[model samples]
Target: MRISRLVILGGFLTALLPVALLAVGYTLKTRALMLDTTLEQNELFSKEAALYIDKVLVDHRNVLQFTAQALGADALDPAQASPVLARLRAAFPLFDRILVAPPSGVTAFAVPELADNGQRVAGANISDRAYFQTVLRTNTAYIDPDVLLGRTSGAPVTIIAAPVPGPNGGVSAVLVGTIDLDSLTQLIGRLHLGASGHAVAVTREGVTVAHPNARLVQQRFNFSGTPVWQYLRGADQGRIASYVDEENTTRFAAFATVPATGWKLWLSQQHADVDAEFYQLLASSSLWPLGALVVGILLSVLLARMIARPIETLHATARDIAAGDLDRRAPEEGPQELVSLAVAINAMAQTLQALVVKERGVRAQIESAVTEYGRFAERVADGDFSAQVMVDNAGDLERLGHALNAMSRSLGLLVSEIKLATAQLGSATAEILAATSQQAAATTEEAAAVRQMAASVHELRQAGESVSRRTQAVLDMAQKTEVVAETGLHSVEETIRSAEQGRQRLETLAERVMGFSERTHEIAEINAAVAELAEKSNLLAVNAGIEAAKAGEAGRGFAVVATEVKELAEQSKAATAQVRRIIADIQRSAQAAVIAAEQYAKASDAGVSTSRQSGTSISTLAARVTEASQAARQNLVAAEQQQAGIEQIALAVDNIEASSAQTVSATAQVEQSARSLHDLAQTLDDIIGRVSVRPGAERRVS
Candidate 1:
């Protein structure tokens, strides 16, 4: 069962058991005490009944004594005797008759009723009866046996006798009082001790005197035959007897002896009557104890349930705690101990709930930190180092984030430095490339200038070649002119020799000339033709001079040619003159011919020297031009090399620029990562600040 049920049941049982035991104990004790009390009450009732009966008997004896003393008076008159008898009968109702017996054995003067009937016998010696005999013998009052007497009428009676002494100290008469047994029996019948309880008067000899039943009165009671009589006879005087009666009915009997009458008074009660009050009392007492026991048990159960309710709630909370519901709590209301337990349990639950919440928060913080770290790592791996995370106020997490941020910042700074270096290197390389390009342009210009110089030198060499060829042609023309002059001189000399031979032939031919003079006239005509030719030559010379003047400087060389022709003609004329003279001076003209030939030879020599000098100058000019062309080719090769070197440097600068760009990209990524880390540190600080901890909260980590 659940703890609550168990606790409640245990408490109920605990409260109920002792109360039930006490109630049962009380019931049992009460029953025993009530039984004893019932018996005692019955005994007391029996004693009261005995005393009532004894009082009646004593009253009867006092009447008898007073009557005896009245009868003993000394007046002794017949007139008084009748009045006294009437007075005695009226005074004592228990008396059947009041009779005076004289000492001389004479009856008293009888009443008229006894005289008319003659019922009285005087001096009859009646002392044989116990009351009469005792009164006469002892001079005291006496009680009679049970008898039937006829005074007014015959009835069973008990007689009381007392001695009347005569005036001189002698007995005068006896006064007898008779009591009706039937009347006593009626009184006994009216006396009620209890339901089924009766009063009885018995003689000392066990004869029934007065009884509730008239038939039993004045009868000899067989003491051994009836249980009530036997119990009364065996019982001590003034003691009660409890036994079954002759009717087989249970009874309580009490017996007392009357001192004056020598009679026994008994009060008899049925046991059912004596025990009736006890039965009702027992029922009430029994019910009281039982009701008390039931009420005690019910109250115990209710009280137990009330006490256990808080504990039960506490136990349920404990179960919830075991099931991992750390927030469960119990109401702290109950008995002192149970309330304390509930309070403690609630405190524990609150503590546990706080702990669980703290643990979960810590775990969440750790996971967040781990996730941020992972993101940082991913950014780094992707070369996007500029990513950063904000840190909250999360104590240790904040510190760790700050540390990561610092590291990232350092890395970013390093990347920035490298990027700066890369940019600087790129800029320097670009400047170098620009300078190299300028150098290449200058070299190209130098090469172009050298090429122009080479072309100029080649043109100069061609010009030199042309000049040499033109000089050679001039020398050849001069030589041809000298040869022509020599030929003209030879023709003149031959004409002179022919003239000398003709003169000899003319002497021979003077006759031939006279004959020839006729022929000479023909010949002279021929001579005249020759002379005309001479005249024509002179005209030609004159014409040549005029033409030279018309030609001016341009016709001078032509005029000289014309002059040479005229000279040849003139030489012919001169030859004619020389022929005329040669006839006479042939011998002298030989020397003159030799001198002209010498002058012509000298002029040829000078022409040869001038041609040689021109050839030498032309060769020197060709050599100088060939050297200048070689220098221009060398300059072209150097310019081509410089241009190639400049291009190579430009390509290297481009590569450096590309490297610088990549470095800048990397530096940007590093900056981004540093910023991200710084943000993460700030987030961690904020989280730490927001978290609440109780006073005296212990730190699990630094």
Candidate 2:
């Protein structure tokens, strides 16, 4: 059930159940009491009707006995009884006749003259009459049943009979006064029966003696088998009973037995009529309770609203909160306890809202910090580490920012150290490579000198065996010339190859340096792009901060986020600056290396040309030694001239030796520089390795 309906029903039950029970009990009690009172009233009416009939009979009998007494036994005959009877009948108009009957069972005299059944009363026989028989048996005045017919009128009458006195003190005749049946009916009709209420009289034989309806008077109203009859049969008077009458209407009746005639007088009323007053009283009394129920229902509705409205408000507010609208709150407008409950709910909502806002702020800050740190990491991967995370006044994030700033400073210092060491190492490696080229050239020159000295010795040995006397000087000169030429050829020809190879290697190195410079330029361009992005990010953060401020308290969380974004932008700016600086250094180093390589190439070309000339001079010296062997005296003279050429070759060889020696010395110095460069490179590698930098593949989250 909905809360409103449930509350209404509950309130109604609480207020109405007991009242309903009490109303039922009152109705039952009132019904019983009213019925009892009605029955009593009916019985009283019956008794009053019985008393009226008895009085009329007693009065009639008294009058007849008095008149008979006035007449005496001396005046009982027709002549003496006539005037007395006339006066008696005149005094009581209800009487149909006044008869004087004897033991002969004949009526001797009757007032209004003769009143026998269409017969003269002077000699009328009444011996068989019940009243006459009753008088003779009882020797007293008696009232007969109203069912007996009058002699003259032939109508039912009450027979009031009494024995006439005898001077001998024995009964001689009976005096009878027949009262009209209508008199009894009129007497009974005078009873206190309201509208729809009536009285009826029945004889002991079940014959209707008197009724308010004349037609029912002499008719057979057989109440014998009924509750009225059963109760009144043994009752002398005032009997009460209930039964369904001839009309199929349930009735309550009371009966009283007439003492004079053994007849029962009944007063009957319909059950509905009997209860009319009770029903009126019942209807009137219900207003109070009905009014109370109406008032209760109204109050119950109000109470139901009081209880349910707050709960409904709370429920609605909770739904809104769950849906992420944390601003709604319950009302505090119900009962005291309910108001307190509403207050509690509102407090809970506010607390939860605050916590949620705080959580959102924290989450945004963390996410912004993570993304900014990721960009910072990217720069660090590209060997730029001069950036620093900006700190804020926020508790945890401020502390985190401080830690990050410290780490960035430390990394920047470490990278600076590494870059300086690498630069020095690169310079040393370049010198070492140059010196190795020069030393290789000098080794070739020495190896060629050893070959030349061996060839010259073989030639001199040939001269000593053939032109032993004149070829001595020629042999000496030839050996010197071959030695110088061979020395120069070895140094010059191999140096040509060494210089070319060195030149090629230097060209390669310069090209590689240029490539590295290009890469640096790319890195610089990337950094410039990052710097531009950071500037845009900074502007966005500023706009966000402004919006957050406009949003007031609701935007506190966003304010934090904006601050974090701005800090990230600043960090990017610092990193981009660092990258640009490093790129400039790389460009300068590449240009210097290119200049050194071009100078080395020119020197290598000069060394190759000088070596070709030395090879030609050695060939000429070999030809002159052959001449000295053919013409021994002419060969001696040509050998002297070859000596001059040998001197010139020696001078050229000496110049080549000096150049080679300088190259070798330079090579040795280059080797030391290379060793130093290798050590510096190892230091740079160790330094770079000290802080592990995962490439872009490693994504960072808060």
Highest TM-score: give the candidate number. Answer: 2
lDDT for model 2: 0.74
Report the poorest 10 consecutive residues by lDDT, candidate 1: 693-702
RMSD of each: 79.3, 59.7
Cα deviation at 311, candidate 2, in Å, is 4.3
Collision count for each candidate, in order: 51, 2
Give per-residue CA lDDT, model 1, range 1-702, as digits (tens). Answer: 755466556656665677678767765676556545544654565455556655765676777677667756632455766687677677766565556666654455543335224565333445556667677778887767555454434446777767777777656787766677876777667767567877777776667777666666534454446666655564545434467765677666656665555566666676576457656765675666556656666775676677666666777889998899876778777688888888888788888878887899879767866876776666545544444556765677778767766666566566556554554555555555555555555555555555555555555555555554554454454445445544554554455455455444434423432342233234334544676697787788879889898989988987887787777777666555544443334333434444544454455445445545544554455455445445544544555555455556555554555555555555555555545555555554454434332222111222
Poorly placed runs, candidate 1 (over 4 Å): 1-59, 72-80, 102-125, 145-155, 186-191, 228-231, 234-241, 279-298, 307-702
| Angstrom error at residue 331, model 2 | 5.3
- lDDT values for all models: 0.60, 0.74
Q: How many backbone clashes does candidate 2 have?
A: 2
Q: Candidate 1, residue 556: CA error in Å?
A: 99
Query: What are the TM-scores, per candidate, against the unseen true structure?
Result: 0.39, 0.47
